[model samples]
Target: MECLTSFCETHLQPHQIAPALKRHKLINPVKNLEDRMCKKHKKPLELFCRTEQMCVCQVCTVTDHKGHHTVPLKKEFGEKKAELGRTKNQMQQMIQKCLQKVKEIKHSAELSNRDAEREREESEQVFTTLVRSMQRSQAEVSKMIGEKQKATMRQAESLIKELEQEITELQRRCSELDQLSHTKDHLHLLQSSPSLCPPTSTKDWPDVSITQNESKWNVQKDISQLDKKVRRALSELEEKLNNVLEKSKGDDLKRMQQYAVDVTMDPDTAHPLIIVSGNGKLVRTGHLEQNHFYNLKRFRSRVAVLAKEGFSSGRFYYEVQVKGKTGWNVGVAKESINRKIGGLYPEQGFWTVWLSFQVDYEACTDPHTPLSLKSKPEKLGVFVDYEEGQVSFYDVDTRSHIFSFTGCTFTEKLYPYLNPFDDYDGSNSAPMIITPVNQTP
Candidate 1:
């Protein structure tokens, strides 16, 4: 029993000793706890994490970074967030500016397009208006030209027809002459037969031959006269036709304008005077006041006639006032003189102004002829002058020059003669007044 108890004690007790030895070799839990506590409570890494763009462990910070400022992870994250916010704001502003610029460009383009469209429309309108106006003018001109052409063609056709008719008449006359020649030959053969012969008949034959010859001479004379008349007619027709052709070819007809004037003559009454003719006949004379009393007469003529001898070639105007004491004849006279009259007249022309009084009319070759002044003529006078190259005749009613010549004179006519006073006073006639057209001074 004692041995068994010893064995059990030794084995069990040995296990117990091992346990105690293990306990003795183990580290101290309190120390390890203290170490972990130090690690947790110690300062963080003092490194410039933001500057380095990296995070460092506490051990690395303590080893590598001495006396350097360090930042917390949260603080770094806050800075990055603030930077990102600023960048985002700037980007937004840039995007807005870009959008605004794009919008402005679009608006400008639209305005430019509108302006171009308007200009194009205006150009098209102007072109269309011009074309329409040109077309209208062209149509008018074409119509006028067509009418003129047709008229000319019709006239030509008429002339051709007349010529053809004349040719046909001449052919007919030639045929008739041929037939008459044949008939005369047959009659001569019959007359030669002896059965047709008689002594009394022979005398009658001679008389008949004389009558035939006379008839033939009359026919020849008639033919000559007809020929002359036909030639004259042909010449006149040719001349007229040529004139028409010339007028058609020239533009003179299109460029003609007419101007007219009128003239009146009157005698002066204030100053009385007398005139003695070469035949010892007394012509009536009277005193004539200036621009007061005168006779009046009217005459008519064309502008061309005035241009031939008058001064004013272009269109002109005039007015006249006349005062007279006695009645006198006033009319136009052709520039023709009776050889029996001594008056030497100008070439054959027309004078729109003339005055004639009773005169001892004796036909003479003298250029100056004095006719009797009849009908209680107190004064007889005429005034003539040219102004602005225009020739005018005036009759003095008063001594004043209030006279105008509106009539044309193709030839100089009997100049009006005025006697201011009779031989009782022996004074001159009243002074005449004259003025130029379009003249102020």
Candidate 2:
């Protein structure tokens, strides 16, 4: 009241404020007629009935709205205004949360689109490069075959030309002899006989044959090998790509590496003629007899040795260095393999890759399946999942898989087998050494 009096004193004169306050208090006659009188009671609406939700006179509030919750109009107005303000604030916060979620969803969608496009481009490039490699291989094979045929045909043509010249000279001699027989010139004929000494310059055609079919057969064989190699290369590439993608999640090589064990050659199982190095990691053919007494587990004729450690279950990996050595066999074999049979075959409990003369790598099987390799592996990594019944071979140098034997039921223990077969030349005299495996990155 004091603040209002001070505001009125400052803004207006005391007598002039009375006229202004009377005008502000005056209600519109049309609005007051409806609001001031109740329709049914014909009395001024004095109270608000909260239960019946309507304006009512004091008598109606006691009769119809009696025994129900009720509140004054001014009190309900204040509560509803406060609730409206809270509702406005809650709605604003909800809108802000929705906007933040929208930003996160849009960001994820952009990243997905970019990742999909990049993978699509990479797939296109992989297939394109594969096609180009196949074309290049075809061209190289064709050129090699053409050169071989041209060389053989040129030699044949040269021989044919020389034979034709010899025939021409013999015909000239025959014509001269016929003329001398028709004439009475015995002296001239006798004198010409010295010049016709049985055509001594003629060459002996000793069945010269152009073995064209043999060359064609060899080309066919080489092309077949090339086809297998290309197929293997593509498979390897796809496997590597899959591994790279899976490495984002986990790596199998790392898990296998965890099971790595140090392996050495066991001289007890080695053949008497096989010499093991002092370190027990190298083995080669030896001229001096081992002098050790023969045993049931020892190999007799096959220059082979077994690893000191044998695996019965679980996975294991080891590497061997075969660099600069030919005519060698290395892989896993059953502990009960025949010692005297000297046969290297799967049915005989021997599973190995054989490197021999004119052959790169051949897996010992019933028919000895030849492996098509891009190059000879200098270091070979062997992995065995004994529980899973799988044995895989890899080129440690190139970090590529070479071969695998799957679905093998190992009833007994398996040992690493190595055979440094009689060396081919001085070139193959290098010992087959077991090298430590370098863990992959």
User: Candidate 1: where is the Cα deviation over 4 Å?
Assistant: 1-48, 65-69, 182-441
lDDT of 1 by residue, 104-178 (tens): 668756755765566566556545655565566556555655655566667667666765776686677666555
Give TM per candidate.
0.30, 0.45
Candidate models: Cα lDDT each: 0.37, 0.76
**Cα-based lDDT at residue 124, candidate 1:** 62
Q: Give the range of the ten consecutive residues with the poorest summed lDDT in model 1.
A: 299-308
Off by over 4 Å in 2: 1-255
RMSD of each: 43.3, 24.0
**Candidate 2 lDDT by residue in tens digits, 1-441:** 211122334554453567645443222234235546667766556567777777777667677778766676667778879989899989999999999867865865675576557656766666777788789888989998998889789978988898899889889988887787787777887887775666676445675667788788888888898989888878976876665554422234444454567999999999987899888998888766679887898888788899989989977888889888767888999998888875787777887877875466877777877788877788887889888888877777666667788888888999999988875356667788888766766
Error of 2 at 35 (Å): 99
